[model samples]
Target chain A: MIPAEGFFWSWILPALIFGVSLWATVALYRRFSR
Target chain B: MIRFGSIDIFWTSLFLLLMVGGAFWFYRLARRSESDFFLAGRGLPWWLPASSVFSTHTATDTPMWITGVIYKDGLRGLWYTFFSAWTAIGAFVAARIFRRSLAYTQAEWQSLRFSGLGAELLRGWMAGWQVFMNMFILGWVGIAMGKVGELVFGWPVWVGLIVPSLITAIYTLAAGYWGVVMGDFLQGIVAVFAILLVSLVGVVAAGGPGEITGKLVELGQEWRLDPFAFTGVSDGDFPMLWWLTMLVIAVVGGFGMGTSIDWYVEAQRIQSAKTVRDATYGLWAGGAITLIRNAFWAVSILAFFVMLPDIKDTAVSELGWFRLGFELLPMGLIGVFFGAILAIHLSTISSHLNLGALYFTRDLYQRYLNPEASEQKLVVVGRWTTAVLLIGSFFYGMMMEEITQWLIFALWLMSAGIWLPNILQVVWWRFNAWGYLAAWMANLGVSWLVVWILPGFNLLPELPDHIQFWLLMALGACFFLPATFLTKPEPMDRLVQYYVMTRPLGWWGPVHREAVRRGLIEETKKESGPVTRSMGIRRSWTPEAAQEWTREDWIAILLSPLVYTGLLFGLVQVLLMQMEGFALLGAAVIGTLIIYWVIDPKLKAVSEEFEAGQARFLDEVEARSRWEEA
Candidate 1:
């Protein structure tokens, strides 16, 4: 079985990075909406 | 050789069709004008080009190189990848400055930054060099994909190189940057997902993080887990001096354009963004994600090490990550992984194909051959050039083995000598076209002697890479510094105009003072105030107020390196389940948030003001190109 830290690095951290990037994009779109 | 199931073939075929077909959707937009073909009309939302930046950098060979270093040096290998940190400060400094200047490529920026016959010569030389360099990059990357194909499907390397490149070329030829950027967005998503999935699976297959660590300890290889386990200050294979050199290069290189090789690629994305704020955030976020991806790969490579601790040959061991996935992934998922590999390959190929074409079309043909070329004619030329680059890459890919020696020399050729001059051109107002040109010429001869020729003759010992970089920089300065002082400065009017438009950072005092004297700009409070206030941190900015370099910009610049360092080290530690990792990661996040809060408003204001005058600036650039103005 994968340890919690292993799962976090392999899974959760990547997901969080992607999530934050997506959120930033949405925020940019909203702020600079044409 | 690994056997592929029916499900694997199905997934791979579907992904190929989807990416290629999706690119065609932009065919009409790409054909509308020269700008559309090369720069997507410079109206892209930040995210679109941000995805392109991330996707383009994550080429087919990226995983191989990362795995090779991690397997050999343990966690300290992560520092090798940290060179991407240049973008952290570059997003705030060079990206903003270049966006405001409105140059199509770094080659074109040459003419804007310098003047007279020297500027034109530099522009032509730079344009030609970029075209050749891009082809070289395409060849190297293509050959890497060819190797992967050989490994997985038992296909000939030539067949592997040509097929995918041909497929990517179809869309690149049809829709230009429009297709490349749009396709890259989709590819980036798929590539990231595959990377995460494959890395996680590798960890699970290796008996998890805890087991991997325990095994390393049992084998007396626990030092591999320590990121700071350097051999010595200057003695061992992985020395502190080399790390220090990397830190300086990565962080300080940001203040200038073209400091890192990746800057040329990122320049296109910076200009393509809809606004300056978008450009800044896009670059920062893309680079941040890339470093994060490296952290994941670093950890997974460790897992590979624990499983197979005795592999010696770099050629076989470099394939460690791939071995883990292909050997361990289930049938249907293997196909999905292969599809992602195609995504990785195609994104990089398409980007370089389009980029090389831009240099040829904009800088070489239009500037020299036909100043009166129409938009339709220029786009036609762009298509033909894309085809040529694609054909050239095939020949280059096939002959890569014979040229590998020269390729290493070529890599050093660009970085070591020209690095400081690259920074000087941006920050120092007095650095003219002659000095810049002389630097390139001097570097060519000096680097050949320092890196190879002298060593071959036994006149000089073979030096470490970092020592060579410093040696090249010092020797190069001897020639270019004299060339700058001996030659006349760029015309005062030209310097004033450039200063007004770009508001560049660093020692531009004379230009700034002249602009104020001419009533071209307001006399700002002393420039030193902002530099001083950078330490305190803080601003709301009016469009006029934002034009001046201020504390907010300084604060962002100061914090950017910290954030990048924190993210790189923090992610690695967290992967190892260390407590300090959590703290470092938190600090990085907080730093990022503060930068956004401090700088975003000013950037928006700067973009708004700059766009209003961009049309006038474009006309001036056109007139200058035609020699209609002196």
Candidate 2:
């Protein structure tokens, strides 16, 4: 018996990771430029 | 005096039975021979090594420590540690770059690069240094884990460290790499599941993340990013200067250490790869896994902060937090969570033992004494060394003495002054025989002198030890590089052919064709043998391999990390929360099954590519060595 409402939309939780991912992706892309 | 009732007894019993039994089962699968004992025949797929590396390192103490740091600092601290995962990936680069070099150990690579007694002496000294260093690290690791055991089982210091270390040592000695890997793999699953399960229970026990975040958020804005942000402490924690110095030393000195040199976890994967590529990918996969796995610990710490804000004596202390978690978790999952924690503890201890033993056998005894020892003898020696190191670690844990009050300083000295100089030579071509050997002797001399003398000085402002170490290394490098060049130029023929055969990415000469025409081999290969180019002296290799973003592999590499992050996120977010109770359980099962199904095939293909690349790299190395002789 627990709440399962908004684990999907936990913006704060994902924010840090998402930012790092975006940065890593962009940097890698800019460098690789195939 | 403290006493535990039947319930407490049951918890310890359950943990011991699961991990020790699992370890025994893994040991049963061990094959005879050096490769089997050390590398598991390099046949395990990506998921296993990926999981094991993180799991083995994330021991009983690690979760509690994260919780303690986060409870004190919040999310930023947790996220900061995840960056080490990035450092670990550098090893993946190392594995891909140097994994399949025909040399058996990182030291062996040095030997191949050097000539005559200069090589042999350098090899022995490096081996000795590693053995000396592991003695400290292994003991510290043991003590850290033992502190957790004390909290869990109400065991005393003697029992806590000795018992666990003994069990890990005995099991590892019997099992070898195959046993360690299987144990670690099983341990990883249990550890993550346990942490996740306890975290859920902790969240339920302490409201939820929303409520928890509200408390943490209210702690002033500065607290969010850096714990020391609002402390008004101008110096910061160790100050900006110190932090920058440590970071530079870490990144720069790390280049010299080479793959399978420092981190035991990296070494395990490096040994087990079917080829260099497999090792590289496996390690990168390890990085990915570490990044994802840290989330569980972070979330759990968040839960702890919410549930027990003022974790005074009992909560913040290593054993104290687990006791708090035990109280929070509901009964059935408690057994499972304990199993996970135990898995984490045992796997970490075993990995440490294996690594410590590795330094003792490969670096010290074998390098110095038994160069012609059979594979079987080495394996036996590895096992015995593991046992001896375990005993030493247990005692060291017991008598964990005070180090030079500035731990960061000593660590820097070890890394920069000692390890960095050696690592630097591999990249810097001017790092010739005399210079390379001098780096070691110089570091030893300067460090020993500084420890005994400089600390007592009156005007000695608080300077970082690592920076000093870095300075010492730089000085050593410059001193050795020039002196050697003036003294002797590495017998021209050996140097030229050595350079030509390796096809390394960097070198000092564009004169190879002209030298070839004129029979000037020295000019053909101005600087000889294997070395790194980026951080070392300037040089470029023939047929320069464009390692990063090979157009064909880029898609797979880029897609892999994304897919992995996505899949993990989806499972944790979507399905785990799609429903509750049995539905949540079903979702985890289904998600794991699906993710594994997709990832296993992809990992296989990546491993095959890496293995092929590594084999070729090895062939090139051997050819280069022979060509130098020619």
Candidate 3:
């Protein structure tokens, strides 16, 4: 029964973590391999 | 029991086909070699191993356990699982250390880290214990799967345990670690989406957040929305002191000592990474995924609370998650959900089978029974062992019908008993073979005395959970210290070799000096500080020899996981719609950016080194292939 604000932000935190870590790892992999 | 519709059956069958097809894709990559079967030829990229590690830990029981926690303690109940952040930090630091040791299994580490009869005995004992442990875990997961099957398909519980387990065993036995990892990757994706689907359905079913909140308030359970408040007993009381005691013990034991990964299967997955960089990043990725999984489950379970507030504690504990999925997910999605549950059970069992086989084949068969065994023979043996383990776990699961009862016993007894020894084996320098033997013996003996013998004889009152935990850890220390002192220390040569290779940060002063004297490592100083690299040393001294943490090592290896752990908790809070948790979310984003910035250079360097190594390996394989053709 969380508010709409809760729904919006809940999605944001996990997305932020997932996007950032994935980007970091892929960037490192590409840089090193090249 | 919920009856399966045709749409459910079709979706479940399709999902199962995808898993099997993915397993076959990896099967072709596997060769008839021990390393190929057991460690993916020790050349996995970060994502494969990381995804596998995350997937393997997400057993069928995971959501059930999380639901039980939320049912009993509300949002604050995450502390129980959050403690693993410490282990993740420890893993980040230890990933390179374990990888550098160049041992195939942790059991084989006995020979790499120590020497003589004591080392041999410890190696054998560890092999046996790990085999037994994996089977126990396999059986535990099987029991959970059986329960899920009984609830979902209206089938006998044993039917549930045997069928999916048999399928998992076939792929694992055929392709070893390769199949296990690939299967895990696919299953991990499906399971995540399934959990998300359930959460989405629940949210809509509850008439959105406003209505859900209204329902919660009407039920007089508004406090459940508070992430910081420790509402005790789920019925709503303050458990002030008890909560504090648990926090202290968990931080000290789980964070301070235990490896971030499962000491067996997950450790094996990390070790199989192509480079130390991959190993560390893989764990970080896995940790992030695990957090996301938790958030999804938490969201769904909270919605369940809103929809079914009047349900009793016993009923919720036994079948809360099952009922929620059955009630909410549509016909086709129910099949998907069922497939996802099977996937969860499959991932756990496959890793156990694969890892158990590795321990037996590498640590026992090669080390003792058949030193001359060929790679192909070892691979065959590993496959056979996987089959045996799967069958054994199936029978054990059938016998242990009551999942809830066994789950409690496992948490309070086996987990507590092993916690101390498990940690000491990784971090403490003085914890030798005898000490390990003594700690486990004392833990089991004392656990038996406190839980069974003393209570049975009425010699003393049954100690409370916290008191018993302390007693077991204390008894472990008491026996371990005495045994270590009384027995001879490990040989100096083995200790020095281990210190040089692993470069573990700890009290290894004597061994370090010996290694230096033997010209194993040279002391050199850069402007930054004294840096110890495992290369030929030059006779130069700029400052006193002292171990200092590199920026990358400190931030990426030690602190990133801690930061990520907070990020995960924050995500859970956000999902619960607590706006105050936005600050924590901000901190997580900032922290992740900082760590990524600091660690990128180190990861780059390590990745390049791994690339060169892999190139050389590929060249050799090509040469060998050509020679065989000639």
Candidate 4:
């Protein structure tokens, strides 16, 4: 089994990066649309 | 022969078909207008060009190169490309500068900034040099794809070189910039998926970050983890002085190229954006994508190191990226990864072909051969130029072997001599065409004499990169300064026009005075008193008409690098699986949000104002054209 810590490091960080990126992208788009 | 299974082939074929279908869709949307063909009618939303910019920079060789660097110098080695953060910072400021200039291409920008014979000469020189550089860049990236083919499919060099080049050329020629950008959007998604897939597999294969750290510590290579650790150490893969030099090149060179209208496709992206805020956001988006991409590459390299500790002596070490995919990825997934590589290669190549055709057809043919040519005729010429570039670069890629050694040799050959002139042309008022021309000539001559010519005569040993860098700087200054003083500056009227329109932040004292005198700028009165025309009184030429940069702009511009640096460090900690570093990740998140809060409202306000102003200007232009026709 992959360690919980391993999943946190490998998956969580990238997921955060992607999640934040998507949020930021949407925020930027809406900012312009207004 | 362990050939690919039917599933692998099917997956790859499906992706290719989708990309080709995307090409046809964009082709249908493209009109016969030159602007549509070259720039997608300059009506693209921020994300299109943003993702296109992100995708274009991810050349196929990028993964292989990053993996090789890790094999040689560890994680600290990423400073080579990481310094590009400066370019992103510069982009924040340059977005407005590029849009306000309103020139179709970087070469055409020469006439807008200057006038007379000097402007004409600069335009011609830039057009010629850009065409050559575009072809050269296309060839370099082509060589990388060729390596990818050889590594993955065991195909001969030429097959890898020709096939992708031909495919990309066809779609680019058929749909022009519209197709190229749309294709990039689709390809960027696949590329991201592939990067994450491989990185996740590598981490799991290495028994997670904990086991990987143990292996590294056991090997006495714990220094591999720290970014700033071995900077000045003399006994490492890269010494302190060498690291400093690379830092300077990345930051300074990146910022210089970032701000200047020197690169073709980047400036095209800026012009292609509908509003200045859209252009600025594109850069921000591109930077975010790049940072994420780099983190995944770093993780993969670290995992590769742990898994293959004993395979240190052979060329296989340098090919760790491909080796990891083949060794760790399942059969069906391997096919997806190959499709991703093709996506990477095609996206970059398509942009180059489109932009190269742009420079050749618009700048050379239409400008010189027939200024009265119709837009339809120019589009035809553009297609022919694309074909020539695609064929030419493929043949050039075939002649290359052992690109690693060649890349090193090319670095030594060219050095960073062109950097100073490039930066100064934007910031300084005195830098002119003759000055720029002299700098390039001197850099080339001096570099050849010092690094190659003199070494041939056995008079001087081959110098290090730092030495060559300094020599180029010294010689570049020696030539450009004398040329500036010797040749006449651009006309004052032209300078004032540029200053009023662009409103660049720099030393433009004389131009500011002219603008004030001509009523183009209103001098702010601190007190209601009669002003005396004293030559010595430095009037703070605050042009009321010029859009003043707000505090938000300043924060976003100055704090971007800090925010990214925080995020990079925070990501590194998380990748190492240290729970305590989650606090750092929290700090990074807070910092990014702070930037977003500061810049978002300002960007919206500014974009609205710019669009309104542009609408009025276009209306006036239409009215005048109609009057003349009547």
Candidate 5:
């Protein structure tokens, strides 16, 4: 079995996710309005 | 390292109070009316359902299960993660096209969509299989929760196993969806917060995310980023192809399974929006946040594996959760997070426990046993079903030595089992009842014959793994559509009428008199059929669906929830991001206020547009489409 590798950077993804969600919310809402 | 600690009186009191209080608060809404019990009286705005979608999907052992995979593989689990993105996105797609589809459960939708021998066969298999699959899935969730309980509080294995299930059944039986949904909303919030807290604390505890990475690099374990980085130990254990194969199954073919209503919390969120516009906004935004949350757990586990390799691999039993909690959180926070786990587990247990009973009452008992049963009687049967099934669910988990495997299998089976007949029939014009029947039979056969036999073969070679069975069933189901379509097409009048009301752009043929007549035709006219309404869905699905739903009140509902979710997400991002530009801040503030203004007006304008469909929705939801409909 390949040894499991350990690394940490899950935090940034959530932040990035927060960003993408906002962008999506704004965009989808705008499309809905128009 | 993470700290395992005791829950003081404050937390102990808080946990009990929240568990008891939250359950009651939710059930109180159910008392307002049976509709309230089953459908939250359709009073809640989009945000609650949207948020609960994430919460509902975030099960007790989900983090550990997914994390366990990452611990074993590297970023390869992203195959599961990315394809799974289609869950919300596909739901959003469905929401836009079929916003009012929530009026019935998934099986009822199948029954309504098909007719003759095929329809009967399809519905029967669906109703039965729905129960079997739901019970199995609910069992894992029950086990995971109990396991967590045993690990955390040092409770007896049996007590830990039984308590949450019993407590959840009580609330779900009393409040029905109202109890589950209301409780889920809060639990979902706790889950997101708990995830955030754990990640932040884990990072700080590990001396920052950067430090965690540095430590990992020093340990010679920094090669996890190359999604395909693996030293092949087994032939088909996993190559790059494994990731690619999973991506196709999970992402591409996943849309087929998107229509199942087992987790109708998300569907209700979309359905209960002030307007189709507002509802989709909540779902879209909520879905977006949820996807991010999934990624958070995904990456955090990467840090975890690097941070504490000695933490050791553990099963999804009580001992495993106990060790994980202590190693992952600080003192008071551990108590707080453990409480969150209870909330998560209870939300699932109550939802499934009640839903499982719902299937028994609606699909089997009412349809098969008592056709004339009143809603009041069904309600009683449903409660009893919940009670009995929940007790059974507790033991279901205990039977599994490696509960997580069963849990994962349950999920895959649930997804693949219904994936074939659900989406393809709804969205694809070529799909038919015969195909759905075939798909279900193949799924049932494979699930029983192949999955049942995986354990014996795993110790040796030559036997297909359980997951491979899932892939085969999903593929076979999807492929069934094209094969059946070539041989036969149901007449336009019978099933097509249902399609006409639900889909405007999707029905085939040119956009003239022929198309109008074709669109207007139902199943009754199939003997003298016009041309097929082929092509694909039109661009204006959301607005068009709303137009059929509400004549003049379209713009308001469409705009308001959008504004509501917009303001909320926009405000959240601005506060969290704090970027340098005045443009950014102005855009955030302006966008939010605009959305807020739209919510009230749209809600007021379209208040009564939904009245007629409400009864039908109740019929399907409370009767034909109950929880097992998923």
Candidate 6:
């Protein structure tokens, strides 16, 4: 099994990138819709 | 072959049902009109098309291609993928200009940008070429799916090519781009999740990051870890000169539309956006995510390399990422992974189907065959065209025995010779339709001679790909530049109208003055006074002021490449736990923040001003399509 740091870099970091992108899209939609 | 369990079947079925059912739900909206079918009614918010951009670009072949390069050249191979970075500057520059033009297709934009017989011929040529290109893309991508199916279930290649494409065609035929963009949002999420999960599992399977790095040092391949590992300035497989050429192509090429073949697909997304700002942000954000996703794939491929360092065949090694997901993932999760693969495949298929149909319906059928075709008849023609393309792709896919060779040739054919002309069309007022048309005709013959004909005859040495690019570009310029000067410039009225509408940047001094003289727009003061008081950057912009090129736009264009480079190298290094990676990532973030700060206000002003006149411009576009105006 990978250590916690390795796991974070390999998985969590990319997950964060995706999550943030999706969130920003939502926010942009709200801003523009208004 | 791997066996599928009940849970695996359930997950796979669930994804398919959701994608097809959800897309079919948009039938009513897509059937509304030609615009609604082709462009989602030109009312999509930034995120909707943004997601579509990400998902549609992430084809089944993408991982295989990325894995092949990363496995061969290590981190340095990522430069091959960086060509997508055109969007970094393009979002601010070309995307804005294109959104203002409000043309439904780039082929249609040709006529709008130029006038008379030359413009008409160029538009016709571009429309037909786009139809062929889109069908070609569908074939290659479909064959990639066929290969995957063969590996997984022992199916014949044709079964793999035809089945999923026919399923994807269902939604495309039913709902057009409405189905495409909506379906893409869901697929984008699933695809991203799968890439992260499988990559994480692969890294763990390589005995973790610590072992992988230590093993690389033991094997004397530590250079693979360096993103800038150039073999030499002019020699070897990965040369410094090649890297520089790629950087120039990726960054500077952004100033022009259609510099990359990908630009044709992006044109649709840019028009689908509701406003100029939405289009800009959508394109930039989508491209950002694509690069970040590449970084993740790079790290995972590195892990694959460490685990199996002795794999000699590139074909076998190219399956590295898929092998990680299939061979390493747990049973139930394997199904989810396969579902994501299907998502990637279907998204690409659906997009090209609709896009090809758009070119056929709007540019060919509606424009030439029946100018007065009703909206309902056009949508029906679109559906019929979608079906025809699906059938055509099967023939192309079956005939294509070698994917990599054809893919490389096609990319070179599209990019190298036409690169300069693509930019000149956007920037130079003198580059009329005849000149652009001549460039396309010349590029075809020149590229053939430089890439294959002369080299095969042993008259020319087999030069490196970068050298070929430069040679092809130089020779192409010799033909097209003369053709441009020999022909008269586009008529003053046509030039003035294009100038006032799109407000294109660079070398448009005469047109700008004419627009001002005619009172089509106001001339701005030099504004060394109160207007220029803020932070040495002009923050406030009137619509007229924003129409002119400014220092802020230049700053964003120059810094954009640095951001892409930083994110690409930084993420890979960070995954390897390197300290410098963190620093580079920080620099990239700062660069992005600065770009947004400097440019957003001007973009907003320009978008607001342009949108106010959009309805009138749109009606004019409709008139041109019907040949009601010359």
In terms of DockQ, the best-performing candidate is 6
Clashing pairs in 6: none
- TM-score: model 1 vs. ground truth: 0.93
Model 4 steric clash pairs: none
Model 1 agreement with the true structure over B327-421: per-residue lDDT tens digits: 87767667767878888899999999999999999999999998889999999999999999999988888889999889878877887799999
Identify the leading candidate in terms of TM-score. 6
The native-contact fractions of the candidates, in order shown, are: 0.00, 0.00, 0.00, 0.00, 0.00, 0.00
Residue-level lDDT tens digits of model 6 in B1-630: 676667677667766776676676677788989998999888888888888889989999999999999999998899999999999989988998899998888899898889999988988888898888888899999999999999988999888799999889888899899889877886787788789989888888888778878989999999998878998999999999999999878888899999988999999999999999899989998899899999999999999998888889988999989988888876666777887899899999999999999999999998899999999999999999999999998988988776658666877888988999999999999998888988989999988887788989999998898988898889888888999999999999999988899999889999999998999988886534457536888878777788788898998888888898898888887888888899999999899999999988988998899889999989888988999983
For candidate 1, the lDDT comes to 0.86
Candidate 5 chain B weakest ten by summed lDDT: B531-540
**Sort by DockQ, best first: what order?**
6, 1, 4, 3, 5, 2
DockQ of 5: 0.03
Q: Mark the regions of model 5 whose C-alpha exceeds 4 Å error after superposition.
A: A1-34, B1-7, B32-34, B226-238, B257-275, B310-330, B402-421, B446-488, B504-515, B518-630
> DockQ for each of the predicted structures, in order?
0.07, 0.02, 0.05, 0.07, 0.03, 0.08
The digit string of per-residue lDDT tens for model 3 on B219-284 reads 887777665675454323445444555555534443322332364565687678888778877876
Give the C-alpha interface root-mean-square deviation per candidate. Answer: 8.9, 13.8, 10.2, 9.5, 11.2, 8.3
Q: Give Cα distance to truth, residue B260, candidate 4, Å.
A: 9.1
lDDT of 2 by residue, B1-630 (tens): 233445444654655654555555445445366556666666665565666677666766666666566556654454334334333334433454345344545565566666667776776665565655566666666666666666666667677667766776666888787667766765665565555655666655556655555656675432542322433323544344544454454333324444223443465566576654456556656665665565555555555555445557635443434654566554444444555566677887787677666666766666566656677798889888877777777666666656524443446555556555555444444456676666667766776555546656743444445355555666666656666666654445544444443322224243244346656333323545664443332233322222222322333333433343343333333312323324443454454454344333433444454454555555555343333332
3 or 5, which is superior by lDDT?
A: 3
Show model 4 residue runs off by greater than 4 Å: A1-34, B1-3, B231-236, B253-255, B258-262, B312-315, B402-415, B458-461, B524-546, B549-551, B613-630
Q: Candidate 6: where is the Cα deviation over 4 Å? A: A1-34, B402-407, B526-533
Sort candidate 5 into its docking category: incorrect
- Alpha carbon lDDT at B70, candidate 3: 76
lDDT of 5 by residue, B1-630 (tens): 234434333453465455545555455446554345455655556766676666767787777766776666655554444443444334334554445544323554556566556765766666676666667767777766666666555666667667777777767878787667667765665567667766555445556556655776787876554346645633455654555554445434423434344334344445555455555556655655665665556555655666556655356321332344456554555655666777777776776665566556656787678777766776777777777777666667678566667666656665656565566676556577778667766665666545566545674344334346456555676657665766566555544445543442233343223435664532222234232222321222222233333322233334333333333334322322324323444554575454344333333332344444546544654443333341
